[model samples]
Target: MRAGRLRGTLGSADRPASALGFRRVLAVFGALVLLVGAIAAFALTDQVWLGVLLGAAFVAACVNVYWVSRRLQHERPNR
Candidate 1:
């Protein structure tokens, strides 16, 4: 361990950082927020079952967004 040296057992150098497009990230964030709000509203109204459904929807949205983002990343090349 040294202050000026990178620390890692695996050999990796100059690997590009991973990230999703900003607008896509924002869209997913908005959808998640809406889903949370819906779940909260349903729970507040004592509609627990509906809230559960919304929760499931939120999970589905998250998975779909992740899959789509991966696809987009693989579909293009970095400049």
Candidate 2:
């Protein structure tokens, strides 16, 4: 064992590609969930306005998540 060194194995490393892939997967899953939720809400409650509001919220959330992930991916690395 030594300072700044792992005792048994390499700890971790940056993997922007993996992070991007994960985001893509998440985005797809979230879109599917949004679709299902909207359909269920409509069928169960007959509330068109509620469905519209939820859809708008989902889009906003997706946009924010995408922007933040892109910003993080392009961020300057510490020297």
Candidate 3:
């Protein structure tokens, strides 16, 4: 167990995640927020087609957020 932990730490020493993953996470969060706003605007305007479109985009952004989170988690060290 110690050896495994050591290896994990060593492998991640030079590939720190703080800066590298932050931008992607921030971007995904921003997109998600924008999608939510668009969804609300479309709903309020009574534009069914645009609302549906925005909903789809919102869903896609949600999935992307999940994927990016998972990827970043994997990139980080266990410790």
Candidate 4:
């Protein structure tokens, strides 16, 4: 009976795909943000202040990627 209960619980705990899916989504979002930032920087190459804004956006996107990577790593269990 105890073995059956354990098996039932383990079966319900099978959510590896959900975690990976979230990470994949975050990665794609971050890439999109970085791409937008790069395009903005190129478009505003003549304006110093706009360049600063684009640089800030690029930095923010990099920080977001780092944060998401940490979250994904934390969610994954060591083998």
Specify the highest-lDDT model's number: 3
Once model 3 is optimally superposed onto the true structure by TM-score, how far is the C-alpha of residue 52 displaced, in angstroms?
0.7
Q: Write the candidate numbers in order of decreasing lDDT.
A: 3, 1, 2, 4
Models 1 onward score TM values of 0.53, 0.49, 0.59, 0.53
Which 10 consecutive residues of model 2 have the lowest summed lDDT?
A: 9-18
Tens digits of lDDT, candidate 3, 1-79: 4543434343376433355377667768777776877778776787787777777777877777787777667766462
For candidate 2, write residues 37-71 as lDDT tens digits.
Answer: 87788889988998997788678768856875675
- TM value for model 4: 0.53
Model 4 spans > 4 angstroms off: 1-13, 19-44
Instruction: For residues 1-79, write the lDDT of model 1, one tens digit per residue.
Output: 6575644432245333334566468659866886977768686878777777777777877777887677656744442
Clashes of each: 0, 0, 0, 0
RMSD of each: 10.6, 6.7, 5.1, 5.2
For 1-28, candidate 4 gives per-residue lDDT tens digits of 5543433221265422335546657776
True lDDT of residue 16, candidate 3? 38
What TM-score does candidate 1 get on C-alpha atoms? 0.53
Clashing pairs in 3: none
Worst 10-residue lDDT window for candidate 4 reads: 2-11
